[model samples]
Target: MIDAIMPDSVRTAGRALQVWDRWLLGCTFVLLALGVTMVYSASIAYAEREMQNSAYYLIRHVSFAILGLVLMVFVMHTRIRWWEKSGPFLLLLGIASLCLVLVPGINAHVNGSSRWIRLGIVNIQPSEFMKLFMVVYLAGYLVRKQEALRNFTQGIVMVSLVVAVIGTLLLLEPDMGTLVVMTVTVFAMLFLGGVRFWHFMLVLAVGLGGMAVLAVISPYRMGRVTSFLDPWADPFNSGFQLVQALIAFGRGELFGVGVGASVQKLFYLPAAHTDFVFAVLAEELGLMAVLGVIVLFGIIFARAFVIAHQAEAAGQLYSARLAQGLGLLFASQAMINMGVNMGLMPTKGLTLPFLSYGGSSLLASCMAMGLLLLIGREARAAAWGRT
Candidate 1:
């Protein structure tokens, strides 16, 4: 009816949006569908306990999913130039938001970490915004300073100083998890941008060593590291989360116990809807579902890199690096979340991209996907002489 009342040109423009990669879009929505199901299954009891309504969590999840979907569509149509031209502003915004989260009264603390700013209805997690903004800004930097990146003083040092400031603020929030993800993603982008191999390795080593030292010096981080190493030894206290995650995986030998049937999500597993959703998925849907989710993400990021390479072949260097960075960001975080669920790594607050139940994560992920689509479309258009 709205279309009927609107101008024909407007209707035509509305229908002009195209999907360059069906696999990317398909896999993402499939994960979102599964996420909706699992979030309800995992959060029903917890939400009831907290809100007296079983559908409380589910309602919020769906609401955010809808909002994210709209944002995804809107972003798909946004001019790619806007992203590049506004890179510096976005970076400033990211930095300011991160600093704001560290301020008293403005920042919201959940589970002891102040990583969010309450914005009336939704809590904004600046780190998520930082991830996307940093990628775009760094990609533009690579394009502008491609030649200078080979210099030891000009390339890595400058980048390191910038990230160090961001990293310090993150540590103040005590959100080491986001810091780790952001650090790895930034390095991956730098590597793709042709930062000297020796420089890359040297900085990587220093970064990892510094993170280790920070972890060792903090009692909270130390406890987590120790728990990850031997959760069984402290199963009742420090190791409880990992132990329960392991139990969920163990219970999911072949087929899952069936949706909503996992015993662990019944207060046995903490963060069943967020950090540990993959484990809850394993418990309910079993190995097949687990492999399926992995394959979906595999398709997503594999296509992402392909898009990056295609963009490169078409002489869009910034677009290429942006695609690579976004792909690596998704791939790295997904692997970490899954590894933590399987007890292969220390538990972190990382969400499994679209599969986890968080409004900020979902929206940010969808926006990333939109960027990927935009990049892919531009690549194909340039290849076909449309540019």
Candidate 2:
């Protein structure tokens, strides 16, 4: 109806604005809304017991969701070239923040890991932001050294050195989960950037070996590995969390008991609203809901790759790599979280993207999605310009 009255130029401009991928954006908002609802369902009783308010976690999560959406909109409006230009500086800042979190008296330790920096009312996890920054920096690096990536000495070695340094910092915090995600993202980006097949395999082997060594050296990690292998062996201690999670899933055989009626979230399962929210979701919403959630994530991942391929076809190499990296980042984290919850992998503190209760992860995910939409827009614009 507005189109009928609007001037030609105004309509054209509006149409251009509509070029951004609405399906991707819709999937994002659906997940966000689902996250808010599930977070409330999973945390209300716990929050009331611990914080004396049933809405404590819900309120904070809503606030963060609002902030994340705003930031995402801001990123969508910003030019991608600006990100490319600032990538290095952002990476350096990320490194500095990671280092700062390890320093005495400045970092906040939770569950025996120092990974957060308290800023007045909010505690920021630098590693979460580091993932986004590393994507930006690597995208730029790949664009700058596309040809050199074919050479092991100049491309593979140099990128590995940078990743090693970052991995070292993360290991200091003992955040093996984030380190693994970061390593996989970098490797995928390098591979997509035309690095030789052999080089990619070699790096993959080294990364897996390093992670194995790290797991072996830490008793806590080794215990987690053993527990993952046989959570039933010590159901009361090391296996407690996974065992409870499995119980949640088993209880939710088909249709769940009902939303907000999860018995496990009352106290049985740990981190119900944060890391293991998916388990709570499965417990309360059932297999259908679980499959629905998986399908939603699948849509996001598939659309992201489509956008990447489109951008690459349009000669937007940086945008292509960034989009691909973002896809992998989201898919990998979600898979890892679900895998941990379902006993397929060792328990990791990785949150499900856009569906877990965490300010940093939510904000970073929104920003990444916004960047992806922007890349899709540019790809469309470039195709239009060509025509």
Candidate 3:
């Protein structure tokens, strides 16, 4: 009835909306809903003890999820050309925010890191925005420098320098997790942009070597590395977090003890609702549920690559690179978060994309997913044009 009353153009767009990527959209919402449930479960005890409100974190997480969904819808409707054009500006804004967060008296210091700006009741983390903006900037750069990318001086060196600058700024915030994600995402984009294999390997070696040196120079990072190697060696101190995480997994066994039945979240596991939320999830929901979550992420990553390939095949280099970069960002972050939870990697302050309780990370992830959907829509339109 509404369609009958609407104009033909409106009806046409409604039909297009009906054909948007259902798999991507469906997986995103499922993870989001699951996240809300797990967050409430993981945070209720802590919230009650600290704030006298059992719904504190859950309320905030849901509010941010709603806001992120709105931003996602807006981005999905906006033209891809706008993002391509505004890429540089967004990058500059991200850099400026990073700088602002490091300034004394302006920055919000929390847990020994100056990585956020306090806004009344909320703390805004700039590094999260940096990941998305860096992807956008690099996507545009890859398109504009496609021809030059094969050359060391024009392509690899220039991009590396840009990444280095971003890394330096992030390290000042001391956000090693975001820096790792950003570096990997950019390198993946360059490789997909057809930089020579040897050049890619040389740059990768140098980047990894530099990170190793940074880790060695930092006492805390070195402790994390050593503790990760043998978490049981100092289980009470340096390895406390990882050891608790492993215990959550061990308790989970095949099936979870049941939702809200987790003992680990009772002040036993650090960051049970934030960085280690996945561990709490495993404890309450079990190995089966954890595997399901992993499969959902795998599907999202696979679909991203499929969309990227379609865009590339349709001759949309900008769209292709953007999709590729988003794929890398999501996949790498998810892997890192899960790895840390399962004790496969050293702990870092990275959130599970759609499943962790974080406003900035959720918003940035929704934006990335929205762009992927937009790219898929355009690819379909281009295909139809050829037909």
Candidate 4:
């Protein structure tokens, strides 16, 4: 009825506006739905073996998804100024949580790395929340110091110091994967914030150089690099995970065996429901599933930048930077996880954003999406001349 009264041009513009906000929310829902189904499929065997309950992970995941959705709604409704003002405190709180994870008794140590904090029902990964906080904190910082950021010393140095401190704490947890993602995302945000090209390049160079040194110095990391180069070299040992993942992909071929029918997730693939869920997904759903997931993410990644541009046009610098940072955060993590599964990159303990079975990750991704929605709402309002 509304469309009938409007002119054709106005109706088309309305559809264009709907495309941005609707696509973001729509793609996220699709991913989250897929996450639930895939998590159950990939974890059924493990959950049954470990917890004696076939639906253990499924129940927990549903619980967290509900919680995350609730939180996302709250975040979207909250005032923007509140988030901007709270960024610093949230960043400091994230730093504190990271510290807590390193302490004895309180920290949940797993696979030689201390990353989670036992929160009764769920073990929360501080690094996940840290990424969100860093984006929020940095976005606000960039907006506050826009002019200063143009200067090499005042802007870049100050931000780098904070990131360095966070990186050191993350290294203490030995979460090099999260550290790399966080660093790269920060660098990408810096570029979007309009930092000088050379300064941005310098930061990128230093970050890359530091990663190389860290890899060379650490036997475990170096082994990963070597194994990634040739997972077949020691297929039953260090390269076991990637080799199994590849096997799963090969089994998947073009179409997939069937849901809940992945042989690899039965016992061969480690972290089947977590880091390697994509492999299990491929084995069960085939190449078409992979392409679909990639396309959905492509829409999300591209739309985030559109929202950022919209925010910029609306004179919302903080929102613009936040959207960009969050966009890179999602895309980088997803790409890295998929790359690892495909044997294109060294194995990293990164979740595939909304698609992985991790409470912290799901919650963080939801909150980030909520913020994007908030920004998008304001931009639309500003564009439409609404109060």
Better of 1 and 4 by lDDT: 4
lDDT of 2 by residue, 1-387 (tens): 223422112124345434668678778888999999999999999999999999999999999999998898789888889999999999999999999999988899999899999888889999999999999999999999987888998679998998889989998997989988888888988888899999899888987887898889989999999999999999999999999999999988789989988999989999999999999999998999999988888888899899999898999889999999999888888888899999999998899999899999999999999899889888877876676
Question: Which stretch of 10 consecutive residues in model 3 shows the poorest summed lDDT?
Answer: 2-11
> How many residue pairs of model 2 clash at the backbone?
0
Q: Candidate 1: lDDT of 214?
A: 92
Candidate 1's residue-wise lDDT over 1-387, tens digit each? Answer: 322422112122244433357778778779899999999999999999999999988998999998998888788778777898888899999999999998999999999999999899889899988888988898888888999999997779988998999999888987777888888999988888888999999999999899899989989888999999999999999999999999999899888999989899999999999999999999999999999999988998899999999899998888899899899889888998999999888878889999889988999999999899889888876775643
Regions more than 4 Å wrong, model 4: 1-20
Q: Residue 179 error for model 3, in Å?
A: 0.5
Winner of 2 and 4 under TM-score: 2
lDDT of 3 by residue, 302-374 (tens): 9889998988889888998998899889999999999999999998999999899999899989998989988
Clashing pairs in 2: none
Q: In order, what is each prediction's RMSD in angstroms?
A: 3.5, 2.8, 2.9, 3.8
Q: Could you tell me which 10 consecutive residues in candidate 1 have the lowest summed lDDT?
A: 2-11
**Clash count in backbone of candidate 3:** 1
The Cα local distance difference test for each model comes to 0.88, 0.89, 0.90, 0.89
TM-score of each: 0.94, 0.96, 0.95, 0.94
